[model samples]
Target: MAPVVTGVIDAHVHLWNRATDPQPWIDPTTMAAIDRDFTPGDLERMLDSAGVDAAVVVQASNSAAETRRLLAHPSPRIAGVVGWTDLTADVAAQLDGLDPASRRRLVGIRHLVHIDPDPDWLARPDVGRALDQLGARDLGFDLVVRWWQLPLAATVVAAHPGVRFVVDHLGGIAESDDEAGWEAGWEAGLRELACRPNTFAKISGLAGLVNGGDGARLRRVVDVALDAFGPERLMYGSDWPLAELGAGAVAWRRAVDELVGELSPAERQSIMSGAASVLYGLGG
Candidate 1:
């Protein structure tokens, strides 16, 4: 049975068209899994099954046109989109091209920060300057850094308090025993980052990271995040298409429910929907 309507809004999902642009993942084995198109129709079907009201479509590629295409699609369920624009680009001109109506759905900006986790990536003077420009535009910055990269990410994030910084996947802790290499640093950095009012954390995507959709390990990580970010700064997201790697959207929904089973009703609501609406400026 579909989960009951808890008034949740899935805060992160990706919709792709394989015909238009093939994702950069070129491994013959893994690429085949997510190489197809997922449109508004696919999203609606999944939302109906999960009983979610709306969602924020985050960018999978650093393509402004892709964001424009998704925004043009007519759907009330698509309350917002975290489109990608090269942070290093001429952001003002690039942002001006996005129609106001379409851009209204754009709540945040994200570039694949983890692609190269040079500890100095976030701390560079040039990168810090770009992030400052993004803050001037009043858009949130999605921090997609890896686990070992959290310490520097915290330093990078600290440089821009004017913008909201969302730490995706609880700092992208790999859902495996190998996570130990950076576990302590990740946890410590999370705690420090949480101390920043501008920072928020997305509690999403554990099933895809760990083997066999490990629910127990995910719960433990969730506990740590909950402690750091608290209910107000935390939000739920279904990393969709990527989530399909571990299990389908349905499996992710189940895992999230089980992981948060012990939370208070209000806490659950905040994590599931409330925080996302407020932070992303999505309508209730």
Candidate 2:
């Protein structure tokens, strides 16, 4: 029997205000559901309804100002912030510039590497140095990369064993015309990445991958993640407003609940909250 899930911690959620951080990637035509600003209040309501106790608010844009704003948010339900920092810059100084309270709220840093023109950005020497600084401070680095970039991410993860790495959105799997080919490549790359002991993955941002939210496809990806990282290195995330574009938050949450329902109580807890708590340093 599936154990009763006592709590849930969404490891990846994004909040954006267009006035400060313009999400240029969002198109009103296609992503009309989430084109508007998503504030802390909106997030709190969603979490409450989903029964999620807390969430790690991730950066939606590559803006330092946005990061500071997110860190300063007064929402007690926001467990931590995965803010942005320029990978090519002096990451240490940038982090040091933050106030003590903001620094404490920051659990990790991320960059929209998937959209960057340079595919080899993660392999640059300067980026490596910046990642080293994050490791030294005991902070995590969230890798939001395309399926093709998974190997590169794995290489970087292996190099920075000291830094806790969390792969966002199951390596950003999306709907592809060549479904079989896409799954094969994604599975291979994800499995290789899972070999890195310091790496973890989020079962988020996946409900939208398929046209109709195919239950079988979702299960397959989750199972692959389970086989690769296991429950200890896997965490749940609503991916929120973006999820609204797909199955909607409530539906996605229900889907995830059903997907992980077969695991033992301890294993289910790990995926639901334990993994996120440990990875993001969220105190009980």
Candidate 3:
């Protein structure tokens, strides 16, 4: 009933307690949809209903302490974590600060690069060195940038061939009818980033972009991404809690099922779980 070919391993998910997590971006004055708290209990119930076997809990706030808390969170379904740190600062110190036992929980690192004031933040020498440190520890780097940042993102990811750079949210393509404005550039940038063997893309966040099951637009975008990165390099993710901002949990899951149902069984499994296993070092 939930369109399950096999167990899915969601590669991007967030669980935060707003009262304690200090999510600066979630202002009740405006963004009310995601202003509430969501914890591991909620995560487990949702993932189980969706038939997901495992997941990677990602950071919503830029707090190092929050990352530690996530690493320490006792969710068995959470197979991995993509934490946050001040990339411009001492990256090694941040990684070293983690307890050895908890450190194994880390699967990748992500910064809210979409909100960074400096457009060239990814290209900065300090950030580059920080990414180097991140990759050296065998963790992947999640590139969550805006659409305009894709070109520079490609360049930065290319510069770090050793790092497993994963582009989230279809390389940050926003939902729009501006075919004349963003279509060409997004396609080119996606292809460019896909050319790098070290780079992977997540077929998530589209629920927040498309109008319901926007078959035409979703088809085009996903087709381009699949063509460029292929199924092996792409992974599935449900940007939960935040997905409430666009399509709520149940609806978005159905949307993903409808869209990805186009793929072969093996391809679907790759997006749902296979890539997540290898890239994040999840269950073998």
Question: What global local distance difference test value does model 2 have?
Answer: 0.87
Best-performing candidate as measured by lDDT: 2
> Which is the better candidate, 1 or 2, if ranked by TM-score?
2
Best by TM-score: 2
Answer with 2 or 3, whichever has the higher TM-score: 2
Q: How many backbone clashes does candidate 3 have?
A: 0
- Candidate 2 Cα outliers beyond 4 Å, as residue runs: 1-6, 209-211
lDDT of each: 0.78, 0.87, 0.83
Q: What's the lDDT for candidate 3?
A: 0.83
19-101, model 3: which lDDT tens digit per residue? 77877778796669877888899899888777788778889877898899999987778788899988999988878888777
* Model 2 worst lDDT window (10 residues): 1-10
Show model 1 residue runs off by greater than 4 Å.
1-6, 26-28, 117-119, 209-213
- Clashes per candidate, residues 3 or more apart or on different chains: 0, 0, 0
lDDT of 3 at 182: 83
Q: Which ranking of candidates, highest TM-score first?
A: 2, 3, 1
Q: Write model 1 residue lDDT over 114-157, tens digit each, in one string.
A: 88445466677766777888787667888888787787878777
